[model samples]
Target chain A: MTDRLPHPLRSDALDNRERILDAARALFATEGLNVPMREIARHAGVGPATLYRRFPTKQMLATEAFADEMRACHVLVEEGLAEPDPWRGFCLVIEKTCELHARSRGFTEAFMSTFPEAMDFAAERAYALRSIAELANRAKDAGHLRPDFVLDDLILMLMANRGIHTISKTARVAASRRFAALVIQAFRASPQHSPLPPVARLSPAAPGKVM
Target chain B: MTDRLPHPLRSDALDNRERILDAARALFATEGLNVPMREIARHAGVGPATLYRRFPTKQMLATEAFADEMRACHVLVEEGLAEPDPWRGFCLVIEKTCELHARSRGFTEAFMSTFPEAMDFAAERAYALRSIAELANRAKDAGHLRPDFVLDDLILMLMANRGIHTISKTARVAASRRFAALVIQAFRASPQHSPLPPVARLSPAAPGKVM
Candidate 1:
C-alpha cells in the first residue's frame, strides 16, 4: 500500500495530519472541545481543506484527541491494581486520575459526556471502573476500606470533584487533591489518617458558591 | 402609607403585585430563574405591562423570587443550631439544607451566583454560615465531628451536591439526601454510626456519565 503512493507527498500529508492532531489536543486541553475547527487548522499551520481531509468532523477530532487520555486512565487503573497494598492502590488511582482530569477541561467533559461515536472510549471507561471495583473489594477484605462503601460512592466522589471551580489551573489541581484526600478519609475503615491537604480557597464561580 | 394611596385603585394594584410574585415563585421553583417575564405574566393572568411595572428587570424578579428560599435556609440553620445535640444538629443542617437546595434549581443558582442588588439575601447567607460555624465548633467539642473538619468542607459538600444531575426532580432529591448521608458518615468521629441510606441510582447525564 505504501509503495503505491508517491513517497514525498505521502510523508507531507502524514506530517500535516500529525500537526492537526497535536494542535487539537493542546487547544482542547486548555479551552475545551468547543474550540473552532478553523482555529485548530490555523494553529496547526494547515489549510482548512487539509484539516478536513484528515478529520471530517469535530466529533472525529474529539474522538482522536481524547484517545490518549483514555489510554492514560486505563494505565493508571492497571497500575493501582498491580500494587500490593490494595487500599493504597485504590487511593492512587482516584488521586492521580482526578488530578489528570482537573488539568484538562476537554478531557473532563469528554470522559463524562455520552457520545455514541466514542464507543471505544466508553469501553475503556467501563474497563477502568470494573478494575477499580475489584480493587475496592480487595481493599475491603484488607480491612482498610469501609465495608459499606459502594461503587456509586466513587461515582459520587467524581461528580463532586467535577463541581470544583477555581480561578486557575494550579488552584483547580490543588482543590482536586484536597477533595480526593477528604474522600479517601471518608472511605477509610478506621478513623486514623494523615492530616488533610491544605484548603484550596474556592473562589466564587457558577453553579457552586462559597457564599 | 395606606392613606396616601387612592382607594379602589390602590387595592387592585396591590392584588396584582401579589399575584405576580406568587406566579414568579411557582415558576422559578419549577422552571428555574430563566422563565420569561411575559410567560410569568401570562401564568399570573396579567399583562406584560403589569409584570414590567412590578419588576423592571430579571434580577429584580430573581431577587424577589428567591427571597423565600433564603428565609427558609436561614430558618433551617437556626433550627439546627437550636438542637440540643450539637453533632445531631450539625447533621440535621447538612441533610435538610442540601434537600432544600436540591428541590429548587432557581434557588440553587440564586444561592451560588453573586448578586450585587441582593444585599439582604447575602446578609442572610452570611448569618447562616456564621451560625453553622458555631455549631461546627460545638460538634467538635461534643467529640462527634472530626476535629479536622473545616467550614470549607461544608462549602465543598454543597458545591458537590450542586453537580448532581438526574432525569427527574425526585431523583435529584434522592441523590442529594444519599450524598448528605455519606458526607455525614465521613465526617463522623467514629465508625459506629448506623448504616447509610441506600444509593439513589445515578442516571446517565452530561458532564458526569455513569457507566
Candidate 2:
C-alpha cells in the first residue's frame, strides 16, 4: 500500500482542528481524562462526527497530546545537560518539573491513563528517567553529590511529585523548594558518610511562612 | 434513663458469637466487606436465625469488625503515649500503626462512604496525633530535636512510609529506618540548630539496587 500524507486541509478546517485541541486542553485541566467528547466538539465549534473523523478515539488524541509533552520535556532535559554547572543543571530539572507539573494546564492524568498505548509512553518516561539519572551520576562523580547515592532515588522523589497536585499552589512551590534543598544537602553528605545537617542549625527560612 | 449492663451471656451464646466474629474476620480478609452474610453464617457453623439475632444487617456486622480494628489502634496510641521516652512514643505510634493498617482484615470503603457515623473515627486519630506532637515538642524543648520543625511534617512523612512500599521489603525497612534516623536528627537539631550526628546517616541496605 502506498503511504500518503493527509490531504491538505482548507484554512477553516485547519483552524477548527487547532480550536478542538485548545478546548481539549481546557477540558482536561478541569475534568481530567473523562471529559465528554461532545463538550470538546461544542467548545471547538465542530460536530461530534467531525471529532470522531479527525481523532477517531480519545486514546489517539491523548496519545498525540502526550507525545507533545514528551517533546517539551526532552527540550528541558537537553538544556539542563548543556549547562556548564552540573548543580545548576540538576536544580533546573527539579525546579522546572515542579513548576510545570504543578502550574500548567496542559498536562493531565486523563491523557496519561486513557491512552491504551501508555506502555510506549511509559518507555519514554523510563528513558527520560535514565537521562536524569545520568545527570545525577555526573554530579556525584564531580564530587558535588555523595558517591554512594544512586540516581534512581532522586528519580523516585521526582516521580512522587505527582502528589504536588494535592497541595495548594503556593504551598506546592514552597514545599518543592524546601524539599529540593534538603535533597541537595543529603546528596552532599552521602559520599562522606557524614551525618545529615542538624535540622536546627541550618538557617531557618521563616517561621510559619513557607518559602 | 440510666444505662444498665446487659444480661450475662449464656456460655453457648458467647461461644457462638466469638465463632461468628472469627469466621467474619477470615472471610472479610480474603473476600472483602461484600462477602454475603449467608456465607458468613455457614462458615461460622451458625444457623441463619442465630446470625441475624447477633447482627441484624450486614452493615452492623461490618461495623463491628471495623470498629474492632479502630479500637486496637486506639489502644496502641494510648500505650505508645505512656512510654517514658518522648521520641520512642511517637516511634511506637508509627510502628504499631504500620502493622495494624497494613495487616487489617477488612476494606470498608462502602461503610466510609455510605454512613456519616463511620466518619467520626477521625477524632480518635487526631487524639493520637496530638499525643505524638506533644512528644515531639517536648523532645525539641529538651534539646533533642531540630528547632524549626513542626510535628505535622513528621507525621506526613511517617504516614507516607507506605508510599515507599513499592520497592522491596528490605527497601521498605531501610526507608523506615532512614526516616526514623532523619526524624531523630531533625528533632535533636531543632533547638540546637546544629548539624546531625554522623551515626544518623543511613546507607541503602538494598545492595546492587539504586532506588
My TM-score estimates for the predictions, one after another, are 0.74, 0.61
Model 2: per-residue lDDT, tens digit, B1-211? 2113685667898798878988887777555565678889999999989999987876667656566776887788788778887656766676566545434324223211223333344466567668777877766666544556565454334323333333333333444444444434334342213332122111111111100
Per-residue lDDT tens digits of candidate 1, residues B58-82? 7777777777788789889989999
lDDT of 1 by residue, A139-190 (tens): 9999989777777767666766766542246656766776677677688886
The list of candidate 2 runs beyond 4 A from truth reads A1-4, A10-12, A34-48, A66-69, A83-88, A104-120, A142-144, A167-211, B1-76, B88-118, B155-211
Prediction 2 global C-alpha lDDT: 0.54
| CA lDDT, candidate 1, residue A149 | 74
- Candidate 2, residue A100: how far the Cα is off, in Å: 3.0
- Reference contacts recovered by each candidate, as fractions? 0.24, 0.01
TM-score of 1: 0.74
Model 2 C-alpha lDDT per residue in residues A1-211, reported as the tens digit of each score: 2114777777887687778788886675544455688988998899998888778877666555556666777777877888887767876776666555544333524312223344355556566667777888788777765565555445434433433333344554555455444444445533224353222111111111100
